[model samples]
Target: MSPDRGDRRAVTAGFGALLSRYRTKTWLGGAVVAGLTVSAAMALRLALSPVAHFYYLPVMPAIMTTALLGRRSSVGLAIVLAIIGCELVVRRDSIADTLANAALFIVVAWAVAEACFRLRAALDAAQTMARDMARRELLLDSILTSTPIITLDCDGRTRRVTQGAAALLGVAPNGALNQPFETLLPGFGAAALQAAQRSDGASRTLWRASRRPNGDAALLTVAAHQLPDDADPEHTVLTLTDQSQAEAARRRERELNDRLSSVWRLNSMGEMAATLAHELNQPLSAAAVYLHTGQADLARIGPVAQPTLRTLDLAKAQLLRAGDIIRRMREMISNGSRAFTEERAAQMIRDLEPVVALIGQDTGVVIRIQTDDEDDHVLADRIQLQQALTNLIRNAVDAVIDRDDGQVTVTGRALGAEGYEISVRDNGPGIAEAQMDHIFHPMISTKTGGMGLGLSVTRSIVESHGSALAVSRPQGGGACFTFRLSRPTESEIP
Candidate 1:
């Protein structure tokens, strides 16, 4: 092939390659626009041929086309316009002028195309930024609407709540806006509100609020944060979290602990039963020997004096009573089947006083027993009732043992026509507030070396008999534990 033909083919290939770089649709649209622009420029030139020059008019269309379509299409449009201008306006004799005119048009078109490209790039960047901003806004809205926590924006100066504060106050969002924050949530304390307003920088203030709505009490944790410097300085962000469920869970945990402690107490009681049996056996054996010896002497003496016979009978009766007491104690240790009977409240107290006195002797705690009604009668398992009373008395003694005026009082009072209430009160340091809710729980003890099961087990025993055991701080100083036993009616007493 000839070198001139080869160079022409290579140039054509390059031009075709450039055109193919653009989409097919763009190329077609550019072609149509270029043709119309050239036709308009030529017509304008022809009409003004006798008058003046309109050289730069065609460049405007090329620049605009470049911005709308692309650089490649604008180049094609510029080339076509340059050709049309050369033919219609330039003189045939002045070849240099014609060439210079064509070159000027091409250069102007290139400059305009470059400007269009830059302007197009700037616009595309702006569009991308707008889309990103829109996506971020959507994400923020989703979080605000779906989160469980209540969010609010408040004005620092007026303490007025704004966005996201309505859900906590149980009001419409629009209605809550511009309202005083305290009015919306009256549970919040004035001190906390004042502190939140003064908070600055990135620090946060935290406080708690309590409310009772519809007879249900709820606890909320409030957190306040300061907004950025560029934002309104008087604006603060507040968030509230409901803690009612957490408090309930804590109560359940305490109850479970109490049950566990009761189990531990049972285990300990089982271990102590053998020791108790051995201690009681010695007294019973001695009493039996005395009775047998007395009988033999009386028979050998051929009928003793009436006073001596009476003394022997009394001794026999007392021994039998001691044996009964021992058997009852064994039954309590075993925690066997209950046997309920009509029993006088005063007699029950008297029976327990010896044991209580022994317990208080070492600690110098005086135990006083008082009965409001000697006729107060209840149907109860005698041994089990005694054990429950024993536990309470022991706890009361321990509470007051350290005081110089240590005293524990056990009182039995008849309630109107229904039951009898027994209370054990002490003059000692009262229960702590932190331990109040969990005192009956197993393994929760305020005393050193305490297994924390006494109250829990006592409560279990009392509740098994259709009653509840309660503890309270007395008006004067110490703790009081009380329980009630239902009494039989007059018709059922006999």
Candidate 2:
């Protein structure tokens, strides 16, 4: 059971085999025993009777036990045999000699037992050490095989990547064992080796690498640990994790936010259309009347009449204005499924014209556009910027639709080197101070039937374009929503 006991047994067996092969005479003790046996046999033959010297045979059992059995059990058996031998060989007629032989046997047996105890202790210690080694091996094997992270063992030039390491690294298997690590992982391997060398005495170290393997766009996060007593400082254990999935998830979240925002703007457009239909219908009816008058006058004159021509020109201008409003309305209602993207500043404002016109036509609230300082071109997605601006104008309209003084002012200007600012100011009830921060968050709206995604989406788009959107009360008790865009460069300023 014990390592020392087992080792001793193996050695003894091997020695016995070698001794048997030699075919030489036995050692001094064995020779003495053999001679004794011969003399006893001859003596028995001469006396014509049996000699009771069976005690001598006990030595054979003791020798065999010492070689084959473990220390404790063997020594115990030897001591018992020695006592029995003393009893068998010492004559009962000589009491003193018998006692002396028994005392001598105790002394020899005690010495043998002490030796056996020390050998047994040594064997036990060795077995315990072997068991501990086996346990550590099992623990390491489990860690290597079951962990999701990749692990590698390297000795500077050579690296051994275990099974599952390749899968984690998103790389095809190359013969990792005994091959140069650089050959397996190329550029990363060199950096990893460099990091490993620097981290030899460090308890913890982190390194970031932004590179795509095999032309794939992904970020790799590598972690390394140096092994104890490592001959080469560059020999380390490496683990790789890809951050591509996390980045993709973030993009998806942004897209979902855009879609939800688009939905909210559409909802607001519906309300705005309902609110402005009356005002727009009245103007359209008046324009139709003016056109009819101009047409009738031209028909009667049948030739170029200055007054009739002037009337016709005015009618044509009104018609164009009416047509522009209708066109803007159509664009607002016509939803395109293209994903929202960043667009230029000039392009973003230009796209909102149609939607702004539609809101003016559909709502009695008068809309005004003003610009003080000029702005450079900006980056924004066309439709998204359009939707955000549309939402702001509509919100302004709704805020003051019932008031005789209802006015929505759209203004723009440059903000130094940072960007351009486009603001929607309305003469309406201002937003409560408590609701400022929450206004941009989804599902927090003051309007009826509002999903509250309008402001939220607006902010998202603004942020995406390296811009910002904010809300505050204007000088005239009204709500104002302002968005800023980064200042454009020489090529982009147009």
lDDT of 2 by residue, 239-294 (tens): 65555687679889997897698668667866686457545766776777777776
Candidate 2, residue 93: CA error in Å? 9.4
The prediction achieving the highest TM-score against the true structure is: 1
TM-scores for all candidates: the values are: 0.55, 0.43
State residue 494's C-alpha deviation in candidate 1, in Å: 28
CA RMSD of all predictions: 12.7, 18.7
In Å, residue 42's CA in model 1 sits off its true spot by 5.1
Show where candidate 2 strays beyond 4 Å: 1-78, 90-97, 107-111, 114-136, 146-156, 169-174, 178-180, 189-218, 229-234, 258-279, 303-494
Q: Which residue segments of model 1 deviate by more than 4 Å?
A: 1-26, 36-52, 71-74, 89-93, 147-165, 185-218, 228-230, 245-266, 288-494
Angstrom error at residue 377, model 1 = 21
